[model samples]
Target: MKTLLFCMLGLGLTACGSSPKNAHSNQDELAMLVGTYTNGSSKGIYTFRFNQETGTAVPLSSAALPNPSYLVPSENGKFVYAVSEMNNSTAALSSFSFDKETGELRLLNTVPTLGADPCYVATNGREVLTANYSGGTMSVFPLQKDGTLAPADTLFQGEATGPDTIRQATPHIHCTVFSPDRKYIFATDFSADRILRFVVHPNNPIPQTSPEAVDIEADSGPRHLTFSPDGKFAYLITELSGKVIAFSYNDGRLKQIQTITADTVAARGSADIHLSPDGKYLYASNRLKEDGIAIFAVNPENGTLAKVGYQPTGIHPRNFNITPNGKYLLAACRDSNVIQVYKRNEVTGLLEDTHQDIVVDMPVCIQFGNYSARTKDTKN
Candidate 1:
């Protein structure tokens, strides 16, 4: 019954040596690391050398693993972490030592998530968290001094249900992430249609704050969330409703302020959501009935979203990313086995296909490593 939710749910950086001098720079070279589902031809995690200068993505290397469906690099670019989306008791989370220069991943350590079918992993260089879809729990692990993971500190479970009997019968924790300030952890419960909030410290595991979590529209199936650049607002994408809801943020409490539809064809299968680096636009990808990316112009004043347009994507765009420079958009189409590249219109917030795609097997997550070869003086 839980394995079916994966198919039914529709979907869904850096180095210690040198810090990202600035968010955007004149250098246009970037390293794109991709995580994939290994049931297909994908071996594990793969890499591509992207040249935003020429709009091309060239295959680099890949590491073998069971099913590294999601990947997150450490803040200093020293290590990378991935969730093995497995259903058996062997389900676990793996850590890898990253070589920024070579764009390679070396398996560091693997630890049990203490839950089944772990689908999401998040880290802030201090603690690592995984949200297990089937087990309905969020597993917490301490980040070792050497980048390895400690034994599970806790397996927090949710017991809330929404109005829908079938999809919201039990807790389905989809995504867990730390807020920008690193003071709070937000975990989304899909079946509960709620976003769980917790207070966390550098040396302490997250403690559920008062009021526990925030309830979105019943049966909305909240999947993922991202905070505004200013940390004054939060945007949540509902997988079941295919809508993006905006909320004002104050001292860890999120107040719902606005909601906008993310798909015109259907109200389901909304996969991933992200904001542009410039914080001027919001984008969410939808699978199933509408395999496209929803574009929204962000109201800088009130943090509201106005649908601008929709760009058709490859089949099942489970995840995508914007280049660090905020000039290109990469859509990882899971079923199509290709990552489509597009030239982003900064002014209009629209994406135009660049026709330079990276072919891979079941590319579900796309992340850009902070490694760049070009110097600051390099020409774009």
Candidate 2:
């Protein structure tokens, strides 16, 4: 079934280190690494090499796997963890060894998630955390010496309570991420519409479990979160309301400070959210109502967002990613089957289309890998 899907998606399994001349200039830096799932019956991972200089991306490698949806590159850039979004009732985390020089992924090992349909994943040091949306829980697993995941050591169940009974009757964990300081784990539940916080302890019996933490408003449908570079504030994207909420962070406690709609009164639909590396700009994408990207200027002192403007992207932009250099933003238009590139105007906090689009099937997530000076030396 998966092989048939890959064929339908037109994703060819190719070798790496053969990027085009314009796509492989020694002076051009590695800007982004986008991941897309195979369409139809396809099941595997496909990675693209993005050149920051020309705003062009070349296909690097395609590896067959099982429904790779969400990807999390390790902080050190040595490993990438991807979730196999399946309902096997025993979903697993698949590990890959990444080649910085060639942008190739070597499958390492896999460990059961102990839950179903694990969609989002995050890692800190030796531990990997995943949010099981269909299972209504979050699970924590340890990374082995060889990069495979260990059996889940902790599971945090979601609580059900909200006005929207249809979608809120059952627990649905959307995303799990760590605080900038790595002291707390924040898991957003779409059904409950609350962000659940957990304290971390490396030596605890279950390092990912914490019962004493605050819960935010119900029915807000918190999806993703980003912390200020200074670690003084945290911003959350609420899917239900199509708004961004800002909160003050003091010693791991997040206090709601403000909320602003990501779209104008004339716009609708929800998408992913991200903050600039300089902490001066916030970018949010919309999936419906004339799909586009929303830009905002961040007030450093109060942590508030001021609307800048919106830029049209392709259809159904499910996720987008910013390069490590902070010069470009890439949108993954799932419905359009193309990844659109945009240049970020640092001064004005706006995005201008780069006129470069990479074709793929159901491209859902975009993630960047750090470029290494060592890799360049070895290549030369």
Candidate 3:
């Protein structure tokens, strides 16, 4: 009865035993994982078959859970970790084992995030980390051999406040990003306007190194950070200021080199950031007044950004990602209830809308994984 109720609750959100077979094996099929806000039509994590060659996608299956607003797959693509962005004590982190052949996600376990409204999750196959937004903390969970979480080791954000009276009243850790080498974890605090780095210790339950930090401009609201494919450069996108800060990374240190304007919309709510597979271009999503993606040309020599173009998107494009081959870019529009697909121009590094969108309620985060050896790229 519980299973039946779950299916009913998801309704059009998921299909039972309806995953597609491995057709066209000659072509590269990558699994696209989408995590959504579940207040509306969305149920939980949605899976799809994305053809790397054709740049097309088809829905596969869905896992019915609470608001998994952000998700990250294990390095080996065997397990996925998701955050339940609920309020207060209801917030939690979930683990699932993925089946590539069937495009299914089997629930492994659930554990409290030790914080509230966890907005981001990351894992290096050794431990899982979550950035809890409302609770002003971060949590680390050691991975068991069976791909389940042991207990959580929480790290308090340690008293941070920004200029915004209401939004920056306290520490709000927006994202926990793993370094390219997987030896360090960086957490961005939106309300705090700071980025803190922690050393990873597989043997120790807590973070080490006293946690080095870099502060942003007052009220800039640092949201998310991404690294270049080669890990030589790091880019941080700020929400309030709508600026992209370029940094040179070495060992485990980040040094700011440039700050460029990406989204200057009246209600600047810049969200996610990513680089193309080739690392020639960068894209940042902006919300509120003008919902679109800002395209910037990455200076390969200096690690700076120059505004190239902008593509208007559905609504509230909180998160988006590029394909492994860098042929297509998908935007998960949270308010528009669809994932817009766009074709990439290799020579110019601009985006052209394909008009092919996948309809799902309140889709926010998009990730590409469960890849075959031929279509896999570990940069993201």
Q: lDDT of each prediction vs. the true structure?
A: 0.81, 0.75, 0.83
> Lowest lDDT 10-mer window, candidate 2?
1-10
Which candidate has the top score in TM-score?
Answer: 3
TM-score, prediction 2: 0.89
> Which is the winner by TM-score between candidate 2 and candidate 3?
3
* Model 3 stretches with alpha carbons more than 4 Å out: 1-23, 373-380
All candidates: TM-score: 0.89, 0.89, 0.92
lDDT (Cα, 0-100) at 190 in candidate 1: 90
What residue runs in model 2 are displaced by over 4 Å at the alpha carbon? 1-27, 41-43, 264-269, 374-380
How well is each residue in 109-197 modelled by candidate 1, as lDDT tens digits? 99999888898889877789999998899998888888899988888887657877877787789999888787899999898888999
Best by lDDT: 3
Clashes within 3 Å, all models in order: 4, 4, 0
Q: In terms of TM-score, how similar is model 1 to the real structure?
A: 0.89
Task: Quote the lDDT for 311 in model 2.
Answer: 86
Better of 2 and 3 by lDDT: 3
lDDT of 2 at 319: 90
